[model samples]
Target: MRRTLGRMLADSRTQPAHAPGASNDPLILREARADDMPAVLDIYNAEVRTSTSTYQYAERTLDEQLALLSSKQTAGDPFVLAELADGSVGGYATYGPFRPREGWRFTVEHSVYLREDCRGKGIARPLMRHIMGHAKARGFHSMVGVVDASNAASIRMHQAMGFQVAGVMREGGYKFDRWLDCAFLQALL
Candidate 1:
């Protein structure tokens, strides 16, 4: 089943380009490579320090990010990125196992991040669409996103993609010296 699904995705055509005026920036989404780690770390660290998108406390080193990327690649998991024409990493999105339990093997959780300046430009929508399509074709039964309750934009975006709120865990995370709520949204692939 996995081999057949992989073959189908490999033969599938690329998604259509963003419509005119969708985004002023010329962005292309593709699988992230080792060379993209530095740029990916920059965007990820920025979000860590300023946004509740991730509950991580400290910035990750380039080596650490590369190791994570390498693990994903080795596991055949997707680590995708959106790049600007100038080769800067505009954003990245990826998924991994939702739980360690064997029963959850077909469920995955994903996250997406865009550089601060890249927000409000519709970059995330197409990025997510691409990821979801890939996940479905790859036989993932469900896709989940754990979003901070304070992040309205991300919550709305997930909803627009047909994800529904599965649950909300109040004060589930402590970050930046405060308790944070996490909302889980899930979509059946």
Candidate 2:
């Protein structure tokens, strides 16, 4: 994870910062292209392996990520990548239906992940602001996130971003041979 962070930060520093107020930092949030898949996959797989940001244990193949992105593109959903001025992807954020039921159509669950070193640089705040703006513009009424209980930094970030702590599910998952608790945060768009 440290190695991944190091690489991301290094890449971030090499790129130029986006011009002020250029719509979520063009250097950060842009429609992801096909070539960005590899960098996205690396960041995603690293999170899966080292943190509870995702529940999956297996690393996703490039093909899988591409398919997912393709589906999002087809649906016109936001699949944004945070890139440095030199165009390396530093992180990503996106959302899908919170549930498959028709009644839940106005609600969605989203996730944002940044390479460790890319954190604390005001990257996530802008990324999330753009995501929420897109969701609201698209008529989504509610946005949700399920965060592992142990990830305080993420919880704080969510709170600071105007997401409330909706609830916590205790002992909801077993990972690494131990029970894990998960918290749900929600923001009304």
Candidate 3:
């Protein structure tokens, strides 16, 4: 029972001038639309197939993306997509339970991805802040970001957002024919 992008935007009482003109800003952060599946999937699959941002070795099907959207919508998770000035989906961010156990309910893990061309335009900070506020309002006590050890940009961004490196799991993941370390960072809400 996910809502359409049109309805979501129209019903959003706090929609923050996403268009280009008076704001002079072209980037739009909003709830992901079903029509944006292809672009979002392309972005995710590219990372899954190439980068260490995601450890999954296989690309996901469109149906998987649809299912994810449905689940997030049902759970009231904050899944947002970034739209470029030209209306293309440039990136996305979402968070889910850090662990499934009842005692872990107060913690969550977040992931943010931006298209190569769209990086460094000051998009991630606001997006992360928005999600942080949403999680805080929902009574989450902390947020965790598990980053690839070699992803300096992501680590820096998390640090800038007040997340501290909790620990590192040495050689925690195996991908692309090599072992990858994961850096765990946490921020108390």
Please give the clash total of every predicted structure, in order: 0, 0, 0
Clash pairs detected, candidate 2 = none
Off-target runs (Cα >4 Å) in candidate 3 are 1-26
Q: Kindly give the stretch of ten consecutive residues in candidate 3 with the minimal lDDT sum.
A: 13-22
Candidate models: Cα lDDT each: 0.79, 0.78, 0.78
Best of the candidates, lDDT: 1
**lDDT of candidate 3 over 11-99, digit per residue (tens):** 33233312111223556879997888889899889899879999999899999999998888899998898787788887889999999
What tens-digit string does per-residue lDDT give for candidate 2 at 47-76?
A: 888888788888999999999999999988
| CA RMSD per model (angstroms) | 10.3, 9.1, 11.7
How much RMSD separates candidate 1 from the native structure?
10.3
lDDT of 1 by residue, 71-111 (tens): 99987788889887787878989988999999999999998
